[model samples]
Target chain A: MADRPGSDQVTTLDTPIRLDYHFSAGAAATPYLRGLAEGKFVGQRCPVCRKVYIPPRGSCPTDGVATEGAEVLADKGTVTTYCVVNVPFAGQSIEIPYICAQVLLDGADISFMSLIQEIPADQVRMGLRVEAVWVPPEERGPTLASVEYFRPNGEPDADYDSYKAYL
Target chain B: MPAAPAPRQGRRPVAVVSFAQAPNVRRDTAHNEVELLLPVIGEVLGNLGITKDDIGFICSGSTDYLIGGPFSFVAALDAVGVWPPKSESHVEMDAAWALYEAWVRLQEGDVDTALVYGFGKSSMGDLGKILALQLDPYVMAPLWPDPVSLAALQARALLDHGLATERDFAEVAARSRRSALDNPKAQVAYDRSADDLLGEDYVVAPLRRHALPPLTDGAAAVMLAAGDRAFELCERPAWITGIDHRVETHALGARDLTSSPSTAKAAEVAGVSAGPVEVVELHAPFAPQELVLCRALGLPVDPTGAGSTSVNPSGGPLAANALMAGGLIRIGEAAARIIDGRVSRVVAHATSGPVLQQNLVAVLEGA
Candidate 1:
């Protein structure tokens, strides 16, 4: 059964609310941000499970223990998973048909998302070796953009068994 | 619905066995939500010589607006060390509502023990802006009225109608601060007299500096167990005999500000008057709301603490009010007295939303 509006008395109004806030990246990301400023990569190691996390989560996600000891990580890693971006929308910074992937950094227990450039979008695949390309020294600061993007390192692709667990 | 609902007769018995809270502080600069709450959870579970495995269910309450981020409760779960994936739930309101959810789950009989906790940091953001988002979106919230202004309006109503005097508010603050001398976890505690507090300037008419709760960044937790599990863990378990919650009209103009009919209705449903209430804990952030609550609940007042019933021996919310945890702390404070063999019957109340619009009442007893 269906009912249609027959000169019904219903009024519609639009209301909008805006709230501004200051965000802190918290204890784990603070050190990581500092590391980025110096063109260095760092991670936190979970004492309970010994899993190293990049951009260092304050607590070990699996064991829920306060992570200790910042481990310096390599800029090179394997692409555990990836997608080719084709759609264009508002605030589109990069050009279309770019590659974005979850890069499992060397010595990191988990994979993090990043952009892959300097290689054709179609060539980007799972287990591809990649390295961070730093921006100009003047542009480098406390941000992920300091390393403009990841690029193919021209090394042999990683073995399937190495990053299968991350997928 | 059953006419004139009778008291629960054959329901399962649940008791609060252990409780822990982070030391109340104006700001916890070094610790994030995970670190701030980790010790509280560890202490609550460790006090009973148990671990997360011993917990059957987990529930927490908190809002993300404090940090202006989403999934704050999920990040807060890191304090629990959730190995093997425990069954859990969360509420965006006060942790008292989380405890209520856990209590309802316990009534189902499958779960024997549950861990309930709440944490918040008011100093992280503009509390006034954060609180304004909770009002009626179309008509009320747009005004962007801060909480103290709203509480001041309620206080003004109390004064204009002679429901209470300004000195009575001062006395509530003075007695709360004085009683807090023995509480190691209170953020604000002193031996200030009511006459001294009256000397302070008013934040708003009928509301002074001492009348408002401190902006506290803290966390609190409670452990609940049913029947034998509770007795085995706690020497004197505070068995919760009655628990109920009720809500009233959201539009402030449609309701009375000087009285809390929602609290009265909730107290009735929870059977608060069935036994002598030896302790009463109300989550009244402003000192004047305590007078309103006492009037609604029909409880005798002895602010000097010489009478049989003691109110806020833990200094209540006037000492330290952590948004998400304030109400749960009230329940924990009341239960602690019963667990220590200090009291027989206690009524714990928690308020949420605007101007005490929603109220939860629980009656705990000692065998």
Candidate 2:
């Protein structure tokens, strides 16, 4: 054995932190979620500026005031913008060549992101009329997943001038 | 033509006009961060008889790690309306840093008023373990040493080095809790004696339960105005006469835990020694750290005693440790004393990282 007592060596220790969290939604989403549980789209309009917001983001970005008066919205809406997902990556849940569109619901001031289906991805254009295809009532509860996807609503495309401001 | 205002070298006076805080609680189940901050922001602004429109720049301090979401501060903006797009910024550190940014912005003379706010909910996750993520990711964070154990090492250093006694820590906790009786927002407060507190079980060696801060969910907001606008807003504004912040080496082994040189350096630059301190509010999460901070700030180890300056009159962090907001709340508490005319001059210190790796010092005075 070596007589020298001191040696330069790095000792490594393994330490891991596993933390669990209970996620709670903000106050504004509580009511909106209740409507989802009931198979309805609930949104609010800003009190200062009567801009309706489906899936209201607690407040109006333009006015910066809490949205007021829960207003149930229609399942059908117009696509103000859209993007075709053609790139493939790991954990790709959906098949390639799907469409992700920003749908501006009727009576809503802002657009919310949603998937478009039942039509060709290239056919999913701005100003496309789409309706929420909901899961069976038994499978639905307080979640956006309640709606399977927005498909063709068999309605004529609205003129771009009608939803130009949203773009 | 007039020599460009002589190229002002000194700081432009910025006064903290109002401060409001939500009650610190172990759990705020009913309200999220936005809802918790809304009332505090309202009260802070309403205290000055003003609104969001009155603030020129809005700065906030918070970390997304606590919220488990990216860009959580964006949603929190709803509490303080940013409509018409106010000049706003945010920091991932405590709100005291946000106040620092606002102070620097005020120096530009473009923003006459600033609103600084911070909010956090430690009860949402394992605050102890989560804090480890802030350690040196390469070596220290991998060890997952929670904040309490790290602070205990510092406390043990104090004890071993004869810097302080266990009774000193108890006294700090006792005095802090007693002071918290007056602080309505404090999460924990009692009239227990120091000796009794000394008998409590140790959360970590040399650090008793009393010495450790109670985890809290809280939010606080403060308003600052530059020059004459401060006079119009608050009758007795706590003017920030001097402010500075410093950080130590990131490697835990590279610095001395027994003494916080960064805190002392910050105190020096912040002109804490220049004035007669009447109130000193410190963001010391543990009791021993309070002694370290007091000594670093050039105050007595027992700063809580009935001395010339009252230390932690708001119970300090031993009462409520709400992470990102703790430091800013210390500054606000000190400024509140000055605003209330209880003190002419005060020193407020805020610390971040493990065992006071970073420190911020500010001197507020009534003008």
Query: What is each candidate's DockQ, to 2 decimals?
Result: 0.46, 0.38
Per-model lDDT = 0.87, 0.86
lDDT score, candidate 2? 0.86
Model 1 Cα lDDT, one tens digit per residue, A1-167: 22346845445545666667655566777788788877878889999899898877578767766888878899999999999999999999999899989999989998989999988898889999999898887788878988889999989999999989889
What is candidate 1's CAPRI-style docking category based on DockQ? acceptable
User: What is the clash count for each candidate, in the order shown?
Assistant: 0, 0
- lDDT per residue for candidate 1 within B1-367, as digits (tens), equals 1111222522688889999999999987777888788889989999899988899999999999886789989988877878889899999999999999999898888989999999989888999889988988768988898999999999999989978888889899998988889899998999988899999998977799999999999999999988778878898888888888989888989989999999998888888778788889899999989988887777875445566678888999999999999999999999999888888789999999888999999988886
Candidate 2 lDDT at B296 equals 91
- For candidate 2, the docking band is acceptable
lDDT of 2 by residue, B1-367 (tens): 1011111124578889999999999987666787788779879988989878888999999998898878989888978878778889999999999999999999998879999999999878887778989998767887788888998999999999999999999999999999999989999999999889878888788899999999899999999988878888888888888889999998988888989899999898888888699889999999999889988999977734767778889999999988899999999999998889888888999988889999999998886
**Segments of candidate 2 deviating more than 4 angstroms:** A1-19, B1-9
TM-score of chain A of each: 0.88, 0.86
